[model samples]
Target: MTKPDQIKNRYNRVARCYDWMESPMETAKFSKWRRELTRQVTGNTLEVGIGTGKNIPYYPEEVKLTAIDFSKNMLKRAKLKYQDDPRKISFIEMDAQDMIFEDNTFDTVVTSCVFCSVPDPVKGLQEIRRVLKPGGQLLMLEHVRSKQKFLGRLMDWFNFVPLNIWGANINRQTIDNLKKAGFTKMEVNNLWRDIVKLIKVRNIK
Candidate 1:
């Protein structure tokens, strides 16, 4: 809890303001990728960093969903979104670095635009891999360091200040992290030359 304070503070402060802060076109485009990824989520699905539960409604009604976030305010706002359909969502206050769920309990692990912000991406990816069942997917929609070297360098330079202020590192190499975890089946679709990334990893059973 204390460890994720910066992450908590930023999102908590923006929980109510996020929709306004986020660009409509950017949000809509990202949602399309998430919707496509959701189609592969069968049986039990664990969604990490599910800020305000934005992806909740997009998932098929038949899917069993469990969502977690460290920010209390973020979860509070998300609860309001699901107030009418509470049974469809089980909200938990937890961290992605160490999920409380049993190993192999989830058939699909969903992460949307979260990897770039995690404090320790390798550990986070490891945790996601740990909870998934055999043949399960680690579906990710992330904003990573851009493929454009110049833009990526700029992001790296500015990444430190935001990391201190909000616990988000905008310059993570998430593609490498998945590989380090022994997840070899990689399908990465880029949006705008690497500003946004959609990665799906089929972990070994």
Candidate 2:
């Protein structure tokens, strides 16, 4: 199977247990981070990798929300999770590296724990930049490789496990990939000892 197919299959298999695996820790550790990052989302907002629609409840009601996931099974579960919500969130199956939207289509793009799983992080970020309007903002909540030598080495060692099981990497340099994708101005806050971060980048065209 191709790389994308492998990713999709792995996520499909894990779709049912995805939220369960993270809920205990995420509820305690990431609730504040999710609220802080998502509160700034406004206007035409696109959330890439809207796994199980966990971010849906946090987003403000006024924003026009469009969410996409590469895994069809993931999108299916997200739709079920948000079906009763009054906010009309459009969910689509889309590859972040090659989105179908026209250029300058979104005013803001948000991602949470997404870049680590993208097969080509820079290419996916470039697509994000392409779809976002000039001066638009990119908000992200991600866990990346630790900067500390010993901890970073530990993450590198364990990275292969997640990659093999879920096609997710634990040691991606997502902030650097953002720079490589042409996001010049960024405000980064270390959320948890530099392993998890809240990053805000603006598209200055």
Worst 10 residues of 2 by lDDT: 1-10
> TM-score for all predictions?
0.90, 0.97
Question: Per-residue lDDT for 62-103 in model 1, tens only?
Answer: 888888998888888888889678446888988888789998
TM-score of 2: 0.97
The per-model lDDT (C-alpha) reads: 0.80, 0.92
After superposition, which runs of candidate 2 have C-alpha atoms over 4 Å from their true positions?
A: none
For model 2, residues 149-169, the per-residue Cα lDDT tens digits are 999999999988998788889
Model 1 misplaced stretches (Cα beyond 4 Å): 1-3, 25-28, 161-166
Q: Pairs clashing in candidate 1?
A: none
Q: lDDT of candidate 1 vs native?
A: 0.80
